[model samples]
Structures are given as C-alpha cells and as structure tokens.
Target: MKKFYYTLLALFFMLPACTKTDIVPFTPETDNQLLEYKIVNVQGSPIYGAINQQDSSITVYLPFYLQLITLEPEMKVSDGATVTPVSGTMIEDLLDLFHKGREIKYNVKGKDGKVKTYTLHVQVQQPDLILQEVSTDADNPNTYSLNMNLDFDSFSFGLDGAGFAADLDMIRVMLVDEQNKEYGPLNISTFNTTDLTRLDFTVIRYKEQSDPILAMLPAEGLYRIRVYSYAKVATTKNPIRINLLNKK
Candidate 1:
C-alpha cells in the first residue's frame, strides 16, 4: 500500500512537465492582393480593368469621352485587406497627378501589416466607326444607294466641335476593278440627321451627284465604302463586296 502511494505521487509530479505553458499564438494572414478593379459611373459605359498578377499591375481601357476626373473605381481585395484611396472615391485630384505621365499607385495592406502596391495604367480607346452594312436602293436601283450601320454616337465631339462634325464628315465610295484601277471617289455630302438619337447617312445619289463619274452606273466591279472625318480618320476592318444588278 505504501509503494502504490509513492507511485501515485510520482505520476502527479510528471503531469506538470507535460502541460504546455508556451503555446504558439495564432498568426494573422499575410495575403495582400488586388483581385478585381473596375471603373464605374461613367457617362457611357462601365469599364473593367485587367489585373496582371505577374507584374502586379492593372490596366483599363477608357473610352475617349470619359475623363479621368470622372472616374470612381470599385475594387476587390483579399479578405481582411484594406485599400488606400478607398473604393468608390472620386479621383479628380489624382487625375492631375496622372497627367504628368505617371502610373497611379494603389496600396493594399493585409491584417499582418504586409502591404502590396499595384500600378494602374489608363489607356484611351480610339473611336472607330465601322461600316456595318450597305445595300442597293429599291426605288432608284441604278441612281441611289444606301449606307447602313454607321455608329455616329461612338465618335466624341469636343465642346469646340473638334470631332465628327456633320458638315466636315463625308463618305467615299470607290469602285475597284480586277486590274486594281480605282474609279469614282463618290462623296456623299448629305447626312440623315432627322433622328438626333443616332445620326447616319441616308442615301447616295450615284447618278444625280455633281461628280461626273457617279453620273452613270458604276462599271461592274468591287465597290468599297468608307466614311471620312476631318477630326479623326475612319477605318473599315472588313471591306464589303456587293454585286449591283443593273436596272432592267
């Protein structure tokens, strides 16, 4: 009975040594990343930014009409991460600093106090008016033609009327032959502005126009249609090829 009592005392003393008093405290997460970014509340449309993880940079393509001063970007970051120049903050003053050809820096700090910086690049997407469709006029098959699907709203006109003035903008229709010879730079001066919502060209009088080449039916060949603007040059990515049947 005395030996069993001594064994119990030894076991009780050993329990204190096994108890862990120096427990490792929980460590805060160290994840700091700018996951998603986008510009919102613009005049036309919201522009989404592309995040490059390799270089830790974000790039956004802003339409020419939208100014940087009008941007209020929305951002998403890693959990428990805080961003400076917080989301939805107007960047008018920041724009002044940006015009100096400097990248805007966005800093994100994690719960662990580790910070990651990301640079933002803003690029202005140029205005392009594509030739959507072209067809022969039914009323005057040989004399009149119609141009369709020209987006006038895409072009931004400045306060001083620097861009896309109806008076200055014109459409050129050229006839190309197998020999690559060009004929008739038929210019359409009249534009259909009755619909102020979306301005467009209505009809092209091939025979009635003053251009002598357009006075008669264009020789059977490939006709290329292009819109011209003094403020900005127009480009046609896909040139249209149509066969105009001579009036019976």
Candidate 2:
C-alpha cells in the first residue's frame, strides 16, 4: 500500500511537469515611418521631398515646366516599412492637373503590420522674369533702360484658370534694395510677343514718376528683382540681384 502511494505521488509530479506552459516572448513595435520624398529631375537625380513635421505634411517642388504635368515622386521610408504608390523610382501622375497645390496620399505599412497614412503636398516652383538686356539712358543719370522677358506666358499659368489670356495684367515687377527693403511693384504695361518662349518689354525708369522708395536707391548698388504674378498671388522663380550702373 505504501509503494502504491509513492507511485501515485510520483505520477502526480510527472503530470504537472508534462502540463507546464511555455511563455511567449513580447515584441515592441518600432517606428517605421516615411522619411523623405523627392521629385526626379532630368538628370535622373532624386529630388528629396520636404517634410513639415509640424503639420504632418510633405511638399515636393517640381520644375516650373513640369508643374502642370503629372508627377510621381519617390519616397524614403523607415527601416522595414513599405510605402504605397510605389513606382519605377518615381511616382507617375502624382501631380495631375497642377493648380496651385496638389495633395498626395501615401500608405505606409510597417513590418509589424501596422499602417499609417500620410498626406503629401506638392507645388511648382515660381516662374522667373529672365533678364534679357539692361540699357542706360544716355541723357539722364537717374533714368535707366531695362529690356526684360517674362519667363512664362499665359498658357504656362493655366489654360482653364481665370488668369488665362490675361498675360499683360498678370505680372508686376517688384524691386527691393540690398537690405531686402521694398521699393516698388512696377507694372509691365506692355509686352511684345515676338518671342513665344518669353515676353519682351522695355521699362523706362524716371526719377520723377518713380515710387518714393526709388529715391532711396543708391547711385550704384546691389538690388534684387522679383516678378510677382497678380493672378497667382505668388512670386516667380529666379529672383535676380544686379549691380546698378555706376552713373557718375
């Protein structure tokens, strides 16, 4: 009877050992987030996307000419995370029908099967007023001659927008001093469309009719030229700085 009791006790201990439970290890989720986004240039270089962490938004600037076309920008994500809208190193048709701004949605799935959605805002760089020539008035020291070209015409802004076909009134030249002080937002009253790629026009600067800020312009100094579009309410690209003619 004692041997039988010992055997029963031994069987009970063995049964507990056989029923032991295995503890599964715990895993913490790592932040596998998207980092940079970029537009591809002509040279096949990746133009990184700009991330605004404050607003949880991304912005990518394309070439002025390509702004109106569709775009597929590339993205860089965190380790082990995959992003949607993937393409052949470039996202295609990402910015179709570019107005002022376009929004792109991205879905990022991490290795842990968690997903995050991101909004990417895309914009085109401002068109510039390309300087063609600068001439000086032989008769007056304060008077100057400027022959400039508008980088883009009416079609470039938009064909269906309200600003279309209003090329002459759409643009104004903003002059600033070396210190970035505002001088004048001069109007380009007339344009010659002899050149399709650009608009050619001449500007005559007279001290008497010029803005009061022009009076502060030094005889010879550095100044910046900004071409603003009234319709778009934005400045064009390539704000150029030039040295004033040393009229002694």
Candidate 3:
C-alpha cells in the first residue's frame, strides 16, 4: 500500500509539468493588470517589428523601434476572449537599460479571481547614434512626403566624426501610402559629399512598389514613415533626417 501511494504522488506532480501549456495568462476583470507588465535587458524600440519569445520575460529595447507583445491561452474563456489595451510601454529612452537587475511585476487577475501578474528586468547601455527625421525646414511643419530627402546634422559627413561614416553600408527607408499600400522597396548605398542619408522615394509617392524600400498597405493610407540603422534609437538628433520636399 505504501509503494502504490508513492507512485501516485509522483505521477500527480509530473502531470502538471507535462500537460500545462507554457504561456502568458489572462483575466477578465482588469485591463490595468495587463498594463503593468514590463521587460528588461533588451536594446530595441517600442514599435518592435514583432516579439521575442523566450522562457523568461519579453525584452523591450527602448528607442529602438520595437514594442512588447503577449498572448495568453484561455481555459475558461468561451466564444473567444480578448484583452483590452493589449500592449503598454515606458518613456522612450535611448540606451541599453537593464531592469535595475530586477523583474517588473504586473497585477494580472482573471475573472475567476486568480492573479497572474509577473515581474521582469533588463541590462542597459548607451547607444552609438540617434535615429530621427525632424523637418529640415521647420517652417514647413508638414508630415513627411513619399518623395523626400534626409536632412542630416552638421557632423554627418567624413573621416572626422567616425570612420564608419566613410564606409557606410546601407540606408533603409519605408513608407505606407494613403491607399493602405506600401510604396517603396527602396534602399540607398550612396552618400553625396555630406554622407547625408538619402532615400529616393519619389516613385512611391504615386503608390508604386519599389524594391530595397519594401512596403505593403492594407488599402490606401499614409500610416507610417520608417528609417533605420541611422542609429539605435527611434528618435534621435542626427545620423538621419527627413526633408519632406515640395511633393516631389
């Protein structure tokens, strides 16, 4: 009788570890619960192209162009469950910010009154450059155009600031048009005298698909303007600039 009891106990313990699906959990009573979640040790941005799935908490690198995302499995939710305010983030910072060597905790609770909140943390560091697209002519005060030029800062060219400027590899630019279509597949590798980051998106303004500057739209809409590799941060002072010229 004693041997049988021991075997049954071991099976009970193993069953949960084997059968339970590993995923973020969800609840019905609180939107604030999910909002409190956070990440650590990631160097990217708030509009991250997608998400990183690991055994631990998701990593969110600030100012990079990445965002945190989570999907929970439902056992009790019927007819499909939904989470409101699905994603949240912190003040955009430009650096490798570790979560103070601690995990961030959220207060997630389900309709059944079960709490699923968790904690996260990350390591931080300073980035090399700033990624931005401020108007070259501030007086214009217009959103970027499909046909535009990057207006970089004064330090932008030559062997003085950094060696990489002379041997730069790529300049990637992308934009989605008003018709829910991506107008570019544009990529630039040439630097005029100033190494002023330039991406020719003039063809895209007419809603045409161009390569090296890839874009895809849902319909017809100018929903996004993206520039990368100019720096690590989503918003920066130099490295790149967007001069929305007069509808070229």
TM-scores for candidates 1 onward, in order: 0.38, 0.37, 0.25
Q: What is the lDDT of residue 71 in candidate 1?
A: 66
Please, what are the lDDT tens digits per residue for candidate 1 over residues 4-87? 999999999999789577879999544788988988876566788999877889998765444344568999999989999799
The lDDT of model 2 is 0.49
Model 3 residue runs over 4 Å out of place are 1-117, 128-135, 140-173, 176-209, 212-225, 228-232, 235-248
**Best by the TM-score measure:** 1
TM accuracy, model 3: 0.25
Question: Which candidate order results from sorting by TM-score in descending order?
Answer: 1, 2, 3
Q: Show the lowest summed lDDT stretch of 10 residues, model 3.
A: 153-162
Q: State the C-alpha lDDT per candidate.
A: 0.53, 0.49, 0.34
Cα RMSD of predicted structure 3 = 18.9
How many backbone clashes are present in model 1? 0
